[model samples]
Target: MPEITYLEGIRLGLQRLMRERPEVVLYGEDVGAFGGAFKVTLGLQEEFGKDRVFDTPISESAILGSAVGMATQGLRPVVELQFVDFGMTAVHHLLNNAATTHYRTGIPVPMTVRAPCGGGFGGGPFHSEELESLFCLMPGLKVVYPAFPSDARGLIYSSVMDPNPVVFLENKYLYRHVKEIVPQSFEPVPLGAARVCRAGRDAVVLTYGAMVHEALRAAEQLASDGGYEVMVVDLRTLKPYDADTVLTAVAATNRVLIAHEGWRTNGFGAELSALVADRAFHLLDAPVRRVAAPDVPVPFAPELENAYRPNADKIATALLELMEY
Candidate 1:
């Protein structure tokens, strides 16, 4: 058991997996010699050599196309998109080919495509985008977004071992900022599962990624200064979400607040809101509130960017409004 940052934990997990499975290989634009844009694969090339840990061309579609073929042929290929925003070029390959392969031919597409996502890095529009909503709509894809370091490591390992295609989104903001102790024998946290980060009986904040920190901060402020108790539930996986855990939390709290980094309209938050309204309608005392980025591209300016994305203050204000309602 060792305390590690989210980035370190993922690095450790990937390193371990590479050792355990000879068939497992990693490829991205700069993963080999450059060690990845975020350094997640730092030193991987030196350890595994360029034959296994190599770099791909700039085209995302090619990277995915190569991975899909390799994975279907019994090789575990972990391909990294430099950023989530860049994944648009490979939509046809991912949404249609990789996602539907299992149903199309009854064959498993055991591939893990990792994308560094979210804002707060001054990465502007092209580099920062929560692109989960696009693929969540596509059937046969396992979309996972982990908020904590341990979850990130465990889920990525599980994704590598899964028989179906998995899209692993890593929050760029949490990569270096968040850290936690990982068990030496870290068991994979089941997919479609949610973690109750904090428990409260008054109101609930359902969220993931960097917003998980924001929601917890908001909850703490509410308890200390506002005297309002707020429960925090981290939806670790977006698609195949743990409705049971969410409903249970909603039943106890009677109020819900959905949060994410994506735009407010037609975003993942809407999906979550619908689920709670449909399944836990009778248990709620107030309408489900959503705290998300504005319906606009991520801005390059610091001040404008701050307003574009959701944060602790915004979440706290929204929770207070829900409490009053």
Candidate 2:
């Protein structure tokens, strides 16, 4: 199989789906003629035409409201918010209308909101923020964040096919940088599945999205320098996270480290930490460690941002402490 960029893998999946499923439509700002801000939808407008794939106004609320309305009418809309940060602007429509429509009317509001997230590559405050925990907290929303190119391609298709509202978080940093041999025929990597990227026995690191690579780096460093085997868990989905996988990894390793690019306080790591504490506390040999960005606004300065973000060195440092404890 030929290798494809992570961004191209997403385009391939959407292109195949749009061609195969007439009900699938693309809606977002600059998605049609402009091919999206990141150019992930480039040339799609020409193939799918303006009707099936088109742009929308700058209002996130309007984009979400329109998707919900279309989903009810039996259209599976793939909505895009340019940046995850702007998703906050449309919280009302997403959390209240689309998320709760099924429970109120017993209907499947099948739609997926795609947004580029994470803070590496100096995207700054507005373009950088990771809001996984915010949507993960909502009862009706299913959040899926994939790290690898294969996962990126597969999860996008599954999210479109899902019955409820799904927030498909794409890391901007992984868009062009990451590449893998995605199968020629797209396959759906089911939601709520946990992939163990690298297996180990001394410690388990639970992570997703852009942070998965960082966690892997930490695992390598610990294994090479510290002589400690580390288990790295890539949570492809967030809201319906794989607790069974997490417990198993924690049980075998006896040490846990949860990390993410999102802020530490009230971040998704906090939720994962609490889950392990509640159910797998007895299996832990040390207090679960969390490595995350400080609870502050994302900075524009590259140097400051580097310090603000948690990377391999930082994660390894925390893991070493956990190993000692």
Candidate 3:
């Protein structure tokens, strides 16, 4: 009902959830007073007050550790990492404590770590990385990475409301760059569901976050020029990924391509490939292909970073290979 940027969607979701639920609190560096690094929380502090929306110290470990404590004590805390790469600082808290809290005991840790991820603006190695799989692989965590502005709003609402630790990956590339008409309501987009962004039959491309746009572009070009109808499947939630949807696509297309901006080696694409191979191998007319960033750190220079990340061109090339295979 309203056109908004990805960042605005996040802000709207936070605003709606905070208004509905008093237990929802936001904590991150410069979140209060300063209003976050990207100003997603610009007016949150003013609306919710400093107690409910406050800034945290520089240490990510401390931010998450405190969130764990608050969550165990019945507060629904939503913490933010300025960048996803910095999440490594609190890996112990994410991987061990926040993750295992409910599984080990009966107490639910309703907390969320919102991390802005991906790089198309030269954030370099220190700031750019898509560690979705890194967190999705962890059993006790729910990892959500939405590509569209509307899904960004819906998923953020769902993640914050869930009674478990959720890693909400916000693509920096999509934050201000992408915009669309979003729903007026704050309905939650259920996690663990796959969205078929485009319908096709020749091949299927499985991806999420910013890469989902690339896959759609590739699908368009493939249809226009190559006459190859490529179905684009967006795995909105990575942790409890939609396996049935993915396998159905693989079975129908008989050709699949897994793409992401993360490093090719051990990237989330690998998991999708494995799933297809294991479950839908008989239906595959060609081997499952993958298009991902090379095994290297995100570069500082724009030109190098452009090459470092996967793009629509690369995705189309991979699709052609899979289609012709």
Candidate 4:
């Protein structure tokens, strides 16, 4: 086993998908010889050729519209957006066309949109936005966000294989910041599953993506600082999230705290909070809390970005409030 970063894991998965499935194709802006804005697709064009792996123009709407067409014609097209924030320009293709294709025309749109999201390095507003909730609200799109390298590798395979539109969000900050030793090969992680990364009885933090790692750090800090054991649940898939696992964690812990890097108002955390309130209202020992970015654009200055982003310290403080409540 070799230790690989989160970005490498995604690339490995893309490589495997292209090699195993000849019908699979990858294209995006600057994704060819340029290797993508973050170099996640470096050397893929040479190995897979310009036909299967190539670059496209700056028009996201045109890129996604073509992908929807390709998917209907029996091609698995993986399109990447330089940043998830830019996706708003062409969301109608995803919402009206790709999402409603199957129900309207009985044709499956098996296209995967790879989007780099989140902010920790001062990408400002245009480059650093967490819009998972916006995608999740669409009826026909499946949203997947991986917190670990192993999960990133496995989920990409599953996302590409699924016979529907999938939004695969990659946390930009975690590309090189997180690493793990994974097997040379592994099984595909099923969509809509949640993993309990840490066990505890006091409280549980419901989160995903980069926040999962922060929740783990907060759990450790709480364990040492207050002798409080905090549980952390990573909701790997957002749309068809693992409700059973979440309810179970809430039942066992009796306290819940939702953490995310997105805006607190109407963010994905609100959905999770609603789920707990609806089904497991009686199981709570305290009011469900949230630690998320305030409702504002992501700041450009490093200091401002640091305050704008939800971190381990914020999570820890929220956990303490939940525990004390």
Residue 250, model 1: Cα distance from true site in angstroms: 0.6
Compose the digit string of candidate 2's lDDT tens values, residues 185-207.
86689999999999999999999
Give me the runs in candidate 4 sitting further than 4 Å from their true place: none
Instruction: Say which candidate scores most in lDDT.
Output: 4
Q: Between which residue pairs do clashes occur in model 3?
A: none
Candidate 4 similarity to native, TM-score: 0.99
lDDT value for model 1: 0.91
TM-score of each: 0.98, 0.98, 0.98, 0.99
Q: How many steric clashes between backbone atoms does each model show?
A: 0, 0, 0, 0
The C-alpha RMSD in Å for every predicted model, in order, reads 1.0, 0.9, 0.9, 0.6
Winning candidate number (TM-score): 4
- Predicted candidate 4 versus true structure: per-residue lDDT over 24-71, tens digit per residue: 999999999889999999999999999998888899999999999999
Candidate 4's displacement at residue 20, Å, is 0.3
**Regions of model 3 farther than 4 Å from truth:** none
Give the distance in Å from residue 27's predicted Cα in candidate 2 to where it truly belongs.
1.4
Once fitted onto the true fold, the runs of candidate 2 whose alpha carbons sit more than 4 angstroms away are none
Pitting candidate 3 against candidate 4, the one with the higher lDDT is 4
Residue 116 error for model 4, in Å? Answer: 0.1
TM-score preference between candidates 3 and 4, better one: 4
